[model samples]
Target: MSARFGRLRRVLAVLLTAVACQSPPAVRAAAPPGPAARASGVVTWAASADRMGEGTAGQGYRLVVHTSVGGSDLRVRFTNAFGDRPLTLDGVYAGLRARGAALRPGSNRPLTFGGARTVTVPAGAVAWSDPLPGRIPAGTDLVVSLHTPDAAGPATGHWMAMQTSYTGRGGHTAEESGANWTQTTGSWWYIDSVAVRPSRAARGAVVALGDSITDGWHSTTDLDRRWPDYLARRLHAAGAPVQGVADEGISGNQVLADGAGQAALHRLDRDVLSQPGVRTVFLFEGVNDIKAHTGVTAAELVDGYREIARRAHAAGVCVVAATVAPFKGWPEWDPAAEAVRQEVNRFLRGSPDFDAVTDFDRVLRSPYDPERILPFFDGGDHLHPDDKGMQAMADAVDLDSLDCAR
Candidate 1:
């Protein structure tokens, strides 16, 4: 027994010595690609794509976006979903926003596509940049600069960004100074989604799929006062498992028809399911369908909700449906539309197709009338909410409901 003990001690001593003498392993700057990495990556920010007039040659866009989750190995996606010809973006850079059209010094970095500096996305397709090696913090104002050398035909973008972005002529994308970016636009061009590899492998994202309210029409511009923004801050503060939020809302968007941005049903795959690491889709639309008086019955609207839930479930994603809020004071509001809204809200509350439901209608409806929006929350249009109401909507969301798995 003594001999055996001595031998074991000597072996352990030699192993320790060898380990101590060897150099430490090099730290990897970027996460390796695999099923694990793929699952861990989440969309930190997103906006739905739509046709935004014609793209001009030699035009550069310095688009500003707000991030929800911080992580490394950042990637940006550009789309040409409505273009008639291939879209070539020659110079693309990502940086931290210092001010209007200006990027933080030393924060601007060139983005590449498969090691190439330039990429041309085909019409009706999207392109993702190779991961940039760095960390971006949550709640950051990220600026994406890109130049189109020969852009023409229909340009794909989000027209109502609710945030300011800058445009320039020629190849001024690499400049960090705001001087070159003299023109201002309230839209985001080319880029639609920004993703990152989160530190926690279990961290995931929720995409808010909705209309103008979700698009933040009435919220204060450049303040990040959107309901999703408020929700993101809440998630971060609470240390929730789902730390990422992607707002896939479009102004005047509908759930059943292709008027505003190719109806929620038609663009579901591209706007929601295709997003990486999305675990839940928060559906809060359908007011337009009811108010438009296009003869869309409550049954038809309910069917659309079911289809959305079914498709999301098939892709291993959960769905949380929000009832359409009151909008009685709007010009389109009438007894017929009010009846339809009530029926649809009832369906949303009781639907088994959804994993959970949020009663935005109850929150926004006035105590005096229930069908009219609460006077305090109204943004004067009776359809949208102000910043305070936006916060209230965010607060009403039970964060746990958004943390479910497939």
Candidate 2:
């Protein structure tokens, strides 16, 4: 027993020393690819023209995105995803907003782009800020003060999946964008998420391109319930890590380039390959493509999925392919579609376009009916999963599979 114990202690000592000597992943300061034409996020809030009294100058909205850590030049996107007409020109500001933990208002600072203080965002368009001298510390709340010219009516924000939180100037007041019973869904407006890149060591973003599932629908709002959040949570938990997950999963987006949104292939480089720290792409798209294009055969969808994998892989990003979950008797589900899904799924099971496979479909779909989904896991719509189901899907991914690429 003494001999065995001594050997074990030596092994443990060596392991501890190795861990102590380890360093954070190398983060090179390099300019990465992004949207060529230029696009950004907008503040889409349900604007009540009634709210516009004599006090209109301060009535408009401002948006801010928070970074994982603070310090460095960062880029921003302002979008108006829920407007009927062109959202007029207005001013935007990015600055530090105090968390309840902070004590004073003197900490706020205005963000500027290219020496300009204002921008005009066309309807359904996004305006991105040129890299600014914004210093974002980790876990710090970012206050995006949007000085609207007037009331910007009912606005929706992207990257605010599963609900998000906001703190007023005083910091005591708190509100969530996903509140069920609000006078107006004013909360959803005002801002999109903020992403940060280290000007010194950061490479770029690892754009997590996918559908609603990847967008983290049904995950607890304000609590950060998206699977990407789960994935991000995992990354942070890692003793020392590399890269970050920049979620670009637009809800209702599709492949083959159609009405839902830019198709997967159409926006592959834009959404996935364009992000910073994007040495990898974890793709879980295509259920919508199959359902929305039922008449389309499995072979075609399989071909498209392979193309997505190939494109990302070509860009030096290790691709991770996720299986599409089952959908039996839903609004979008059709027998023919199910057949096609099955065929495509089979091909994805052992394909090489992907560096690895994250079987989100296999883990959640019911055993009794491969086509029909399990009742417990299905959201009432039968298409999307409930929060629990979403978590299960996220949990199904194998973190080890991504290590080689990292």
Candidate 3:
């Protein structure tokens, strides 16, 4: 019995020793929720993507975009979302914009993908360039130059950039001189979003998700007079923490249905939540849905809004609902649409789903006729606001409301 007990103790000792000598299995840390999970960088500027005309081979495009927040490690996102075939970009460059397609000398830097200068975005996919080692300032007219060696399918781009861009015949993207980039275009091609690493760790971004008005339809081109632009300047001047701004508005976008681009609900993940460091979504849409008269009811639109708020909340993002602006003079304005708009605005004003509300209808409505937009703010179309109106809309928003606890 003593011998058996001693053998058992020796076996147990051997087991313990073997366990101590062996390594434990590797464990992966849990991924944090939401866009910060990617943590590549924060979005400084962005434009919504839609189906544009067919892409041209050997076409070099010089896209002029405005940045909202200053940061280093600048990166650009290219989309082939609407393409049926692979889109290959052989040369891509980023630089500070001087006059008319001209890049500031020595500021033009070539961008690479996974260490290669060329990248082929798969059909229905998007790719982001490796970070460029540099810092860009807020409100910089950043230029992205790219040459597509064989891009043939339907192109993906923003039609109403509200800023002028240029196109050259061949791979002239490396040239800083504007002489090679003679042709002018009003749209931005290929690229959809630009991101940068902010100096402050807590810095976040806000995305304006809406329609043509938010797309800067009536605002002066090249001036960056859109309401969101004004808001960006305000955030910068005040030294707000949420400094980045992305305009994800399409001209004919709706809340419930697909038309101009994917409906706000469908594209919410890609355009809003997926954006890095997006703290809030300033939802100013639903005007197109009401005006289109597709038999969409107020209840349906309200449901859409509620879903948006819920999804955003689940992703740790705050939602600021904006009342739909009055448009009594626009051709689509009728008693039925006006009724829906009024009901939606009522819901937006009091809904707990949103973190805060901005009464744009109250700000833009004419005192003499509550249903009509204020003439001073009207862009003559009665639906969209003029530059002054845009400024007023931006001013009405409480900057503090945008920076909320999520």
Off by over 4 Å in 2: 1-59, 64-71, 79-91, 95-107, 120-141, 148-193, 198-204, 403-406
| Runs of candidate 1 exceeding 4 Å displacement | 1-40
Clashes (N, CA, C under 3 Å) per candidate: 0, 38, 0
For TM-score, candidate 2 versus 3, the one ahead is: 3
1-406: candidate 1 lDDT, tens digit per residue: 2557534543553354234223221211111122322323899999988777788999999999999989999999888888878999988999999989988999999999989999999877788899999899999999999999999988888877878799989898889999999998878999888999987733889999998899987787788999999999998888888988999997667899876677889888888888878989999999988987899999999999999999889889999999999999898899999999999998889888999999999998899999988989998879899998999999999999997756
Q: Give the TM-score of candidate 1.
A: 0.90
lDDT of 3 by residue, 224-287 (tens): 9999999999998988989999999887788897766777887888788878779999999998
Candidate 2 lDDT over 220-338, as tens digits, reads 44455566656655544552233355666755556664434346776565455544445566777778778875466777788888888777777677777888888788776877788
Q: How well does candidate 3 match the true structure in TM-score terms? A: 0.90
Error of 2 at 138 (Å): 4.2
Candidate 1: global Cα-lDDT? 0.86
